[model samples]
Target chain A: MESRALGTGLNLLAFSPAILIYVYTFPYFYANINLAVLVLIAVLPVVKLLVPKRYSSSVYPVALIIAMLLVIATLFYLINPSRYYYLEIFSIPLALSTFFAIDFAFAFIFIFEGLLSKRSSRMIGYLFLSLGTMLYELSIIAAMHEFSLTFMNALSLVFSLEILSYYELFVYGYQKFLPMANFQIQINQELLVLFIISTIAIVFSIYLRENGHQRERLGDLAYSLFAGSIMGTLLFAVYDYFSYTQYQLSIIGFGVLATFVAISRTSRKEKNRKPKIK
Target chain B: MIRKTGYIVLGIIAGGLLESLFIGYDYYIVALMILFFVAASDIISFNTGLSRSIRNVEVRREIESNSARKFQMRPIRIFFTNRTRKTVYFHYYDTLSDVFNTEGDFQGYIILKPGEQTKREYSIASIAIGKYKVGPVIIYAEDPMKLCISSYTAPVIDEMIVSPALSDIYTQRSERLSNMKFTYGIHYSQKIGQGYNFYGIRPYNESDDTKYIAWSRYGILNGEDIYIKQMEEERQIDVFFVVDYGIGMNQGTRQKRMYDFVIATVMNASYSIVKNHDGVGYIINSSKYDYFIPAKKSQEPIRKFEQTISEIRPNGDFSIFQTFSRIKRDVKKNALVFVITPFSYPESFRKGTRKEFETNKKVSLFILDPYDFMEKRKDDVYSALMKNSGLKHYRYLTALSKFFNSIGIKSSVSREKDLLYRIMAAYRYGKLTNEGA
Candidate 1:
């Protein structure tokens, strides 16, 4: 409890400057990619360090994303050397360098805690770290535009899915091992479909933005699509929680419709199979 | 194939319905493009010369590599051969077993060019112990139109056995401390100054040299000569552990609860006792005497001890008393006993366990509380119970602790809160005083 309170307080205090900066420079964020990336790369590790070390798996993807971003920036520089006159040749790369180093250090500690340590609290801490790392990596992709973006987006989508699957597994595991309470959530085929659609949409949005002529608009659209879908899902979850709404009603409806179709088709088959009574 | 088509159809329907609602034909156009692309790909993929050859393509791999021990990673190489003329893109899929849960970076597609023999190495670590089969390597070949996709499943599956890691006995603490005093013997032997009892002995044989000669008997019998037999002052303490191996015990992560903990505890105890020259540990579960190595004052015997514990399986009902009863007959001499369990049984059952425990007060029972090793965060039930009107949850600790106390078995509780620390603390307490209290 003390650690949590301290972490929250630290984050609040540390975030004040960033919040103030963003408030003063809201609309100019799109044009100031260099500044935004610098600020993000600088502040993320601080915020992460402040966020009480629970999520371990988050560090790897975050580091990988940072590395990929540097590579993208280098490619950008090579593609348009004269256009880069206004920007520092090594600024983005330097920021990314620090980002990788910091993320790696944190990840090493978290992974060690997860794998070697016998403490359950530490393991839980590592899980949270992993969750945070995924979010961080997503934010970075939301900021960048390049051909590699498609692959990164696909990876991030898969990573998020993996995290959710792992979370469900952990919850089930807790129930199975401790018998404290049952996990009520039953992930059905519809949810799987939804997941696939969301992932595909996200991947396509990224791919089109990077490879197509309208690359400039692609980044923002992709971000909005991701944000919108997640928000929609969150809204559903919140509504369900507060109203005790049975989301399963829709699933049941699907099942019943499926059954109706099956029976009707089966009777038709039976009709076809029967010899006409002469 | 049906699942894939259903997705494409659902996308089309959803797009078409939305297009109908809106006046623009853009949604319909997008929907049509998606459908056309999918259909086209399916047809092309199905008829492509590459995919046609893949239909009857038998891809076989003669795998030869060392499989890892349970919980450790090892690399295995697979040699693949495409027995057909055309190229096939193969992707391996396995019915993931409970034991294989390690994360590796090799689930993507691999394209095998025609008549090519390729070898790929992948590492697998088994989280649990059991037999596991690998592969129904799916080969996907599609035509240029990206139309019908054809895939083939390989007929052969490879099997691998994963064993557990073990430690050697000479390295055990007990034998090292004893300085090799007690030698390994198959049967019970009467050694002088080693036991409390004395038995008759009359031998002037070559085997019974001056080192073991009975001076008093020789003195009494005069020149004709004979020797007397005396019992050793102390003998090894034979420890027997009866582990629970029911379905209930398999509820936790990595399946078996008692099995994993027992292995760890047994290894630790065997290490400690074999270090203390006078102690020897033996384990029995089910009806089988799984490990019966009498303690020797040498480290070599500890290897056998470890291997036995590593091979322990979860079988039979969890009857603590039954296991104890069996142990009593097999263990001829006094030995310190340790019982590791997660007590979820009723008071009557515990009472019976206590009765068996009292039969040997020297027993040191370690109740490895399952809640400690495997914990779940539930609503605050204890506070609810105190609140009288709030929600309540089942707290297994308070009741379990009371039961242990009632039975006079020194019990320690381990929780997920600080499991290793708690265990270490309990072990320290155990070492501080032989009594659990």
Candidate 2:
């Protein structure tokens, strides 16, 4: 049994490179929709089902899908080095995707670096700030209609990507550093409405490509979108209500004020009595 | 509020930089909208946050029962209120008992306008036993544009208890075993009568019976005194102890002390059984967690058994019959079985719960009641009612002991700490009775 297990291990070692090569090439042979769906299905199963239960719990499957995108992006660069100057801007998408794909690694590394008092990721945050600027700049000067449309769509996609990064920063900063400041912020209804509206626009633009029909029927999807928005917004409202209302304002305020007046009164009494003591 | 405004300005600056890179001269509109959104959202969130801070927010956690042991899941309820005029928004993040080793992700927002209350309910999977501290509910809120996020951690603490596994270990009728000598020989009759070993005999006194005499010694002593070798016959006896590591045991700031006390009792009992050279074993039945090691002597197999005991963490779900069936396979010989558990779950810890406990074999059963000893004894009327309930449960245990005794199984009951003292009391009484005889 031991020998057979060892042989199987060796076989897996030999086949790993073959599997990597197939993963890189397979997506190219298929259309983007088919490729994306296929990658999603395959990656989800391998990470979720085939792996041991404990390891599966620790490793988020989202990271693998992101990694696959990074591999594809790297392969694209390798295949077309001559077009590097024209396509250098596309690297922003690749860089952001890599961060998403390897989030577990990034989380661990950040935790370690934070322990060591190194602020390298803060620098990366600044770099993302810079690249986001550059992408916005490129979106305007694109000469063709298709080019501008693609650029605008891509920028919107980047906006959605910022959700995870910002959320991570908020949690990390709140947990480690700004603990005393009571940093719980509630989600507002207006923000939820905005998110739903923006999501609908992106979905209609990407999925429902009938330009005139989509433009005319965009309002149809608004109510359901708003309904979805309220679910999260409602939870945020309660938290905000409790934190600000309960102890911080009324009870605490009156208590402090009463204490202050009493202290001042006692001090005045003491002053009046000081001559008698002398 | 100022911090929020600064972030909004920074966001606008970022948008402008993007605008310059993309539309160059014509990128002003998008930059302006992003700036406007950030500024408006921050202002709204800051004012709302400040206003809501003045209102009363009530957070609560409701467990199914204050007293529960391993294998039982606890339900948590959170209530949020907005007592102020302006509407408030917030998100809830719950942390569970440490045994779970993972934080639950339940981030969602609620909007509570003034004089309105919102509630959320979630069930947490209970994995381990001990006193579990339930909540200091943390709420995260941020301005609408995601510029500034604030989180307020609650300052409330709640606790729950998880019980331990029970073993069905009943010993047969035996002498009272005690550590010290007693004036009254209550336990002497039980152990004084017999054993398999032969000791040196003494000359027959006036009370010596003619039945226990040696003819040759009678002849050598000229019929004045007869001597016979004293022989001891072995008589099998049963004992029982029931241990509970239930939720009530899970009170107090430190959970380890309760758990340690229960474990120490089991170990000491097992050690006594081995030293006594009797067929001794114990049963650990708990409603909170499933762990049962049958009574067995200390030897090679017991090393593995000890390892199993060491590895057990307090858990809340247990099946007694299933555990018995598993432990049955390990015991091949006729030996005593001692039960140590908190009989909490009615369905699981009742009379029909374990077939092994009812088996018509030469097994002795003992139950050590942990709850009776560990749970806080209250003096109020409600506490008096609870105490009465405890007493009723004790009567039930004693009745169960009588049933086992009728079936040729020696059964006894004691608090965890008094187990060794009881055994020692029994042994001492037996010795004095033998000397008198």
What are the per-residue Cα lDDT tens digits for candidate 1 across B1-437?
22243334334433432231121122222322232233223332334344446555454544444344566765555556666775565455433456666454335455566777766566677665434565555555333222124555555566655444433122334435442332332123334443555655666666544656677777565676777465644334434434444433444565434455455455554555445443444554543334455545454555565455444455544556765665566555554555555554444355545666554434544555454334333568754444442111124544565676678755555443443344334333333343221
DockQ of 2: 0.01
TM-score of chain B alone in model 2? 0.43
* Candidate 2 lDDT by residue in tens digits, A126-216: 3233323332222221221223345336445434334433453345421111111112212123323433343333222211321112222
Which candidate wins on TM-score?
1
lDDT of 2 by residue, B217-328 (tens): 6756564666865555544333323344454334233333444455555544544444454333444445544444444444332333344444454446445455455445
Please give, as one word, the docking class of candidate 2: incorrect
lDDT of 1 at B151: 55
| Cα shift from native, residue A96, model 2 (Å) | 32
